[model samples]
Target: MSLRTRLQGRFQLMAAALVTVVQLPPVLWLCWLTRTPLPALAALGVSWPYLKQLQSPWTTTPRAPSTYVALGWWSACLVFDVLMLPALLAIRAGTPADATWGLAGAVALLLGGDAVLGRPRLRRRTVRIAGLPPELDGYRIGQLSDVHCGPHVPEEKVAGWVSRLNGLGLDLVTVTGDLITHGSSHVEAVARALGGLRAKDGAYVSMGNHDYFTDGEQLVRELERNGLHVLRNRGVVVRRGEARLYVAGVDDTWTSRHDLSRALAARPEGSPTVLLAHDPDLFPQAVERGVELTLSGHTHGGQLGVPGIRRLSLARVITEWTAGLYRRGRSWLYVNRGAGTTGPPVRLGAPPELAVITLRRE
Candidate 1:
């Protein structure tokens, strides 16, 4: 192999090995940290030493390995507050501390609330456009993101989400990429799931990091084949009511290597613009290009974060609005919490979400 190829191969090997090493320590530490006394159970042999050590009746309840693992994670987080406090404190010198408390207040605020409330607090955010074209009134855009389909996929569950989207009665639907976990095998199912959607403008789609890792070109072809507009650095002049709106889509932050110029190239001059990008971090360019609003989803709100405030540090590399609408001067951006999971199946403080953006005249 060439030197560069050999080095890359070695680095990948090291990365895989390091992941295993880094993840093992926590299990070892938690087991060694060793909470409470144990009483022998006869159900399955002598049983694990730490099984009875759990303080929660729920954690100790007989359940599947996944359930035990889930409870074990929550319990470990509860017990390990002292460990996470320092990091939170250090980071908060620049940001608010209550948000840290919000994240760290796992037992009472998160787990307790999740159990008691049984639902997340959602906000219906509305923004008025002063410069919006006169003909466009009640212009609605629906967006879904990060629907990473794979093994153990709740197709029916996802179908429910799709059904909810259809109920919104939106003017248009858009996706912020990561349609499948690895490839296009089940993309047709997703198309069918979202196929029932009736939009005056039609559906638009983009590519994400996972799409590149999977088969991006194939996805674009398939989605286009299924009647979804796959915008790869392209723009379409969509007529909303009597007004004109430029709906543009950029290549994903990681995959298509986005270029706003190419996306806006085909747009009519001086038309109100809305950009559909996979990462909301592309706001500055969209703003510079006179985009009035942008829609995105990639962070999944850390997928393991605190509510109300964001988990930017947890996802350190992505945009700031983990799962909400944010404004930077004249530009507005809505970042979805995402519709699926990656790495782990649990969504703690965050939920899979679909965003409805309604633009009204001033």
Candidate 2:
């Protein structure tokens, strides 16, 4: 095999081993504390269908049963680490056990409910752009990102998102990558479902890191075949009466296919522009390029957050521009929390989002 392929294989093995190590200890501890093997046995039973995923994280299709088990296990572990463990420590330190357990239970239930039952909601935001053409001032764009369609995220869910976006009467629609979870198996189905998106200027897409995990080229072809424009380091211009708007997209940055300079090379100078990049880390570069607005969605808003706080999320550890809107100078960035899930198929405080952004003249 090629060196790159070999390296990828080795990396997947290491990741699988790491996840196994991290996930095993909590279950073992639970069994020990409970003085029974039932917990351990039950964990094994639930994980059995997904055992192949441990060794090959990117190869297996996620099913509902395994998906639920994975979500439940992740929630349990999170509760244990964040709440249960602390409560147990307090109980050992002469604290009242009743109060501690009660609080832990309440918080756990709240978190669990939000993770499993929360649905994607519509988010509306208006961006003021300097030099925006009067004709283009009220331009509306609908964004759906990271809709990881596969076994876990069914095609039906994607179709529903498309229907909702269509109802918004957007001028343009953009999907900022992570179109499928891993393999090429679901690419056609996802593309077909997303084909239902309706907009005056049509839908545009950008590649994300996860899209490259399998056959990135095939995904691109499928998306294009279904009438979606996959912008790979390129752009297109749309006109609104006398005004012109330039829309462009670059490939996934993680795979090094992104070429911001090339993507913007064909743009008419000083024309209002919007860029679709999968990773928000490219925001700084986009701002430097004078992009009026950059849309992105790779962080998934950390897939968890505090209810009242938008900035506080697990994604903050990876990026300051975790979710929502960010600005620097005259440029703006809006990172969608995405319309689907990956890994455990669970969402908490940071629910999935379908963003309808309106651009107005400054």
Candidate 3:
């Protein structure tokens, strides 16, 4: 293995060890204080799936229902520690045993319900583009990103999303990336589900980091076979009577295939353009190129947040462009919160989203 890969593996191991150290001690102490082995056993049970993930990390696809439950439980415990640990320390007085369980239960139920039942909801936005063609004005495009169709997200769910998108009567549909989580196992299923999507133009897709993780070429073939256009550093023009709208997509930034110049090379001069990039970090570049609208989704809106104030999300620590609309002069970027979960399959404040964006001439 390369030195960088080795270092990353070692770092992952250390991080997993740290998580175990931080999370287990409190649960074990509580179990000891209560003189009950049940909580301790439950903790271990919930942690097993997560531990397996650390062991194999990239290869093990979490498919079991119990695995999801365990993951949810583990996430709840982490949240509990973050919220209660400080309060427990400040009080000095021992917390009632029942209260501890009650709080844990409540956290688990809330987080679990949000993760399991909080389906993607449609969010509508209107963007005014400078010098947009009259025929292209009010062009509605549906966007989906980070669908992550795998163990946590089933084909049926994707089918439902397609049905909903189809009902919207969009002019076009675009999926930003992260179509599959781990392997080729669910690629066909997701492709087939997404194929049901219908629009006046067509559906376009860009690659994401996770898509490259498992047989990206195969996934592309499957998606294309199902009638979705997979844009890899390419642009295409769609016509509405006399007006032309240019839509372009580049491969994911992480995999080193993102060539913005190549993607835009074929663009007709002065044609209003929309760029489909999986990472919103490319927004600056898109702006420099004067791309009218950029659509992306990799943050998953931090997958956790406060409802009204999503800026407080933990995802902010990772990226300044965490979610929602961003504008720089005439260029605009919209970051979808994503339609599925990744690591723990749990969402707190940030719900899954399907965005319907309409373009208006400024």
TM-score (C-alpha, index-matched) for candidate 3? 0.84
By TM-score, the best candidate is: 2
When sorted by TM-score, best at the front, the candidate numbers are: 2, 3, 1
lDDT of each: 0.64, 0.82, 0.82
Poorest stretch of ten by lDDT in candidate 2? 14-23
Off by over 4 Å in 3: 1-45, 57-62, 65-69, 78-117
Instruction: Give the residue spans of candidate 1 off by over 4 A.
Output: 1-30, 33-106, 112-123, 311-313
RMSD of each: 9.2, 3.7, 4.6
lDDT of 2 by residue, 188-272 (tens): 9999998888899999999998788678888888888889999999999988898889999999887689999999998998798
TM-score of each model, paired residue for residue: 0.72, 0.85, 0.84
Give per-residue CA lDDT, model 1, range 1-362, as digits (tens). 75435534543454344233323445445555665222111211222322333222111123356544544454344334423554455466466666565456544444532321122233355656767886766788888788776543445655766677777778888888877655455666666665655677898887876666545676677777778898889988888566788898989675347888999898887677888888877888777877888888888776655545575324444455666887766678888877786543555556667778888776
lDDT of 3 by residue, 95-123 (tens): 67655665665555456435443678789
Q: Residue 239's C-alpha lDDT in candidate 3? A: 91
